[model samples]
Target: MGTDNRIQTIEESTVYGLYHHGELIYVGCTTLALKRRLCFHRSDASKGNDAPIYGYIRKHVDAPKEDLEIRALDYDTEAAALQDLGHKTLNAQAADGAEYEGYDWTSEEIDVLEEESLNEASKRLDASFNQCRRAAMKLGLIDGDGAYTRVDWSVWDEALGTMSDPKLAEKIGCSVANVNERRRAKGIEAYQSRLSDDKVRAIWTRYHALEEATYASVAECFNVSKGTVARIIRKETYQDVERPPRITIEVAKRYHAQKDKSTDKGRILA
Candidate 1:
């Protein structure tokens, strides 16, 4: 049908053709209200084919909306509405033209799958690369090449003695997965948390005794987090009390006009 046959206005329950400069940019049928669909086409959504069109409308802050036209079209069937919707048509290619065809594997193709990588075999047999890969995996053809890539672990082990995991990953030209595998094999812990019940008990005891114990003071005393102190005191009843969220500047000043926390007498014992 010619472009002249297209309707100028949008109608309810109609198959719409969105045009830009008289070329059909998109085609789709919406049973919902056409007004809502129009709004949805500009709703800052990046789903599929419409993503680029909506993105352009959003990005060009000064562009005129008048340039594009949304018009109703005539289609005898629902299938016709989708058949000619977009600028380009997607059609299936011949079996030989592509590396894959919808072919069930014979016993022969299945037997020699482990001979090479899935890609190389697919090219040789002129089959679908994805299908061949699936078949290979099911038939245990995936193990022809050993799973591990051999690297000199001696250098990596030496580096691991002093260097961090991230730095070691870069140096060995492998991923963090390999680095972690080496650590696990060598019985090396990534990071050992040094927190103990004895330390927590001491901190809690000292904080409960001192009325002037601020989170900063308790944190400095035990070298632990202020949040940890707050959680222990407020949630678990460490001090049987908790301080206000913020101490008044006057109370803090009365406690100490200026105190250096680095020194021993900076805070109230705790």
Candidate 2:
């Protein structure tokens, strides 16, 4: 997924040392505003958010606010600190506890699992944080009280895997031939290509935008080849972007603002 334009630099004081039961469980280094991230953790814990680490904290400990200690870890590079923590987490062994026995934190067998867990955590944090900021612009908080909406695609490409291209075309009110042509313009081989959730969300959002204004309109607005817009809408090729459920309008605004800034700064292009 693409990074947001609102990216902030991390300082030494921003790194946080995390401990469980007075023992170091992990160290988290982030470029997100410290106060914001901490608040997110607390709010997420209350809402049972879908973050692996947050879920782990909620499940393994009671009163995580009190049990899980957050201390400052001075580091020149927060990313490096996070990497070190991952390596340490992969190397450390867990001992039997009053609540559980033979807890192996660093089992070679589960190394892949640990790595996947860490990567998921990173992705979740980035997405959630961006969505929260966007929501805050229009809504005070991200709420789960909205109606559910699904996007369907119509055109299908064998290379893209198993996506229903015809259904997508029907949903978007476009011809399958047009969809396929757009995909070809974007060099997209299939409709159901393996893509990250973020990319899927971006494609959906873009497609919806095009639907609101028509494909030609969106192509003109983005100043890209019509085929590019069509391919994106058709999911021929996916672009990574953050997607958070129950995201607020404020967060969306922030996301757009960041995207615009990135484009202007040559950090990203449509």
lDDT of 2: 0.46
Query: How close is every model to the real structure, measured as TM-score?
Result: 0.23, 0.26
**Best lDDT among the predictions, by candidate number:** 1
Candidate 2 off by > 4 Å: 1-13, 30-36, 88-270
**Residue 246 displacement in candidate 2 (angstroms):** 56
Model 2: per-residue Cα lDDT over 96-208, one tens digit each: 21111221222222333223332232254433423333222112222121111122333333323235545544444334454566555645445454445554564445545
- Error (Å) of candidate 2 at residue 62 is 0.3
**Clashing residue pairs for model 1:** 99-127, 100-127, 100-128
User: Mind giving the per-residue lDDT tens digits that candidate 1 earns over 1-270?
Assistant: 432211111112456666656666556555333433454554443343345555555554233245555566797433465566533412121111112223555545654445655545666775776556445433433321222224688766645534566566645644456676876566443433224445655565656556677877998888877867765655432231233333433445444434444455655665
Shift of residue 168 alpha carbon in model 2, Å: 58
Q: lDDT, candidate 1, residue 229?
A: 70
Alpha-carbon RMSD of each model: 19.9, 23.9
Q: In order, what lDDT does every prediction score?
A: 0.50, 0.46
What candidate 1 gets wrong by more than 4 Å, as runs, is 1-12, 45-50, 56-64, 76-78, 88-270
